[model samples]
Target: MVLASGSPRRKELLNNIGLMFRVQTSEIDEHIDAHASPQDNVMKLALQKATAVANSCDDAIVIGADTVVVLEGQILGKPSDTKEAVEMLQSLQGRVHEVFTGIALVEVRAGNIYRTQERARCTRVWMKPLDRDRMEWYVGTGDPMDKAGAYGIQGIGSILVDQIEGCFFNVMGLSVSLIDEMFKNWGIQVGTKIRSQGV
Candidate 1:
C-alpha cells in the first residue's frame, strides 16, 4: 500500500498500526474551490493525491488523506511561516473549531484506475485560551510551521487544546476508525484500536 501524505504523524500512526506501506507525498494543489462544500473539497484533494501516486505504481492500493482547520465555515490551511502560524493560533485560541479529514483509497492496475472509497470526517476541537507567552514558545519549537491549523495534537501544541469531540486521531491527522471503515468497505480488516499516548 502507498500512503499519500507528507505528515510524519500520519506516517507514525500507520506504522504503529503494524500496517506495511510505502510513503509517497503528493504535490497536488489544495486551494478549495468555492463551489465545493467543505467535505467535497477535502475528498477531491485526497482523491487527487491518491490517484496521482497510484497511477505510477505497478499495482498497489493508495491511501490519501487531507486535513483542514475550519472556522465559521472557512478552511484554514497550513501556515507559511511563524507569523502566519501565530495569527492562526491566535484566532483559534479559546474557541471551538472543526477539524475535517478526508480519506480516499484507489487501486491501479494495467494503467486503469478504480476509486475504491472516498469520504470526509469532521471533529469538533476546543482549544484552551492561550496567552502570548505560551504561544511564542510553542511556535518556537517550529511544529506549527507545517501542520494545518498551526497546532498538532501529536506535538507540543497539545497543551493548547482542551478536548475533542469525535475521533482524536482525526485531530492528529488521520482517523483510525474512519480508516478501518474504509478498509471494511474494501473487505480488509484493520483489527482493533491502537492505543497511543503523548501525541
Candidate 2:
C-alpha cells in the first residue's frame, strides 16, 4: 500500500490507524479549476495524485488525499506568506466554514490501474471571535502558513475553533472512517491488515 502525498498530517493519520503503507509523493500539476465545484475539484486532484503514483507500482493500493477550506462558496487554500496567512485567519474568525477533504484509492496491477474509487467528506467548523492580535499571534507561530484557510485544526489552531459539526478527522485532512469504508469495498479490513502486520 502507498500514500501519494507529502503531508505529514496525512502520514500521521494513516500511521495512527496502524495501516502499513509507504509514502510516494506525486508530481502532478495541482492547479485548481475555478469553474469546478469544491468537491469536484478536490476529488479530481485526489484521483490525479493516486493515478500518478499508481503508474509506478506493479501491484499496490495507492491512496491520495486533498483538503481545502470553503467559506461562503469560496475555496481557501494554503497561504503563501505570513501576510496572507493573517488575512485568511482574519476572514475565518467568528464565522462558520466548511472543510472538504477528498480521498482516492487506486488499485494497480502490472503497473496498470485496475480500479479506482473516490470520496469527499465535509466538516463544518466555527472559529472563535478572535481579534487581530490573537490572529497575528497565532500566525506568528508559523503554523498557519501551510494549512488550508491558514489554520491547522489538529495543531495549535485548535484553540481558534469554537466548535465543529462533523468529522474532526476530516478537518485534519483525512477521514479514517471514509477510508476504512473504501478499503472494505475491496474486501480489505483495516484492522485485519494491521493485525496481520503485527503493528
Candidate 3:
C-alpha cells in the first residue's frame, strides 16, 4: 500500500491505525477549480494525486487525499504567511465552517492502471470567538500557516474549535472510517487486515 502525500498528520493517522503503507508524494499542481463545487474539487485533486503515483507502481493500492476549509461557499486553503494566518483566523472565529476531505484509491497491476475509486466526506466545525490578541498569539506559534482555515483541530488549534458535527478525523486530513468503507468495496477488510498482521 502507498500513501500519495507527504503530510505528517496523514502518516501519523495511518500509523496509529496499524496500517503499513509507504509514502510516495505526488507533485501535481493543486489548483482548485473555481467553478467546481468544494466536494468535486477535492475529489478531483485526490484522484489526480493517486493516479499519478499509481502509474509507477507494479502492483499496489495507492491512497490519495485532499482537504479544504469552506466558509460561506469560499474555500480557505493554507495560509501563505503569518499575517495571512492571522487574517484567516480572524475571519473564521465565532463562525461555522465546513471541512471537506476527499479520498481516492488507485489500484495498479502489472505496471498498469486497473481500477480507481474516489469519495468525499464533510465535517462541520465551529470556531471559538477570538480577539486579535489571541489570533496573533496562535499565529505566533506557526502551526496555523500549514493548515487549512489557519487551524489544526488535532494540534494546539483544538482550543480554537468550539464544536464539531461530523467525523473528527476528517478535520485532521483523512477519515479512517471513510477509508475503511472504501476499502470494503474492494473486498479488503481493514480490520481483518490489521488483525492478520497482529496489530
Candidate 4:
C-alpha cells in the first residue's frame, strides 16, 4: 500500500493503525473549485492525488487524502505566513467550523485502475474565544503554519478548541472508520491483508 501525501499527521495516523504502507507525495495542484461544495472539493482532490500516484504503479493500492476547514462557506487551507496564520486563527477563535477529509483508494494493475473507492468525512469543531495575546503567542510557536484552519487539534491548538462533533481523526486529516469501510469495499480489512480475487 502507498500513501500519497506528505502530511506528518496522516503518516502518524496510519502508523497508529499499524497499516504498512509507503509515503509517496503527489505532484498535483491543490486548487479548490469556487463553485463546488467543500465535500466535493476534497473528494476531487483526493482522487486526483490517488490516480496520479496509481498511474505509476503496476499492482498496488494507493491511498490519497485531502483535508480543509470550512467556515461559513469559505474554505481555509494552510496559512502561507505568520500574518495569514494569525488572521485565520482569529477568524476561527470563537466560532464553529467544519473540517472535511476525503480519502480515495485506487487498485492498479499493469498501469490500469482495477477498482476505485472514495469517501468524505466531516467533523464539526467549535473553538473557544481566544484573546489576541494567546493567538499571537500560539502563532509564534509556528505550529499552525503547516496546518489547515491555522490549527492542529492534536497539538497545542487543542487548547483553542472547545469541542468537536465527529471523528477526531478527520480533523487530523484522516478518518479511520471511513477508511475501514472503504477497505472493506475493496476486500481489505484492518489488522489483516486479504485482497479479493480480481481486485
Instruction: Answer with 1 or 4, whichever has the higher lDDT.
Output: 4
Q: Local error of candidate 1 at 137, Å?
A: 1.6
Q: What's the C-alpha lDDT at position 36 in model 3?
A: 100
Between candidates 1 and 2, the lDDT winner? 2
Arranged by lDDT with the best first, the candidates are 3, 2, 4, 1
Model 2, 1-199: lDDT tens per residue? 8999999999999999988888999999887899999999899999999999999898888999999999999999999899999998889999999999999999987788999999999999999999999999999999988788999998788899999999999999999999999989888899796457431
Q: Residues 47-149, candidate 4, lDDT per residue (tens digit)?
A: 9999999998988889999999999999999999999999998999889999999999988988789988889999999999999999999999999998889
Q: lDDT tens string, model 1, 42-151?
A: 88899999988887887677899888999888789899889889899999999999999999988776667855689999999999999988888899998898888999
lDDT of all the models against the reference? 0.84, 0.91, 0.92, 0.91
| Candidate 4 TM-score to native | 0.95
Q: Candidate 4, which segments miss by more than 4 Å at Cα?
A: 194-199
Which residue runs does candidate 2 get wrong by more than 4 Å? 193-199
TM-score of 1: 0.92
Worst 10 residues of 3 by lDDT: 190-199
Model 3 regions more than 4 Å off: 191-199
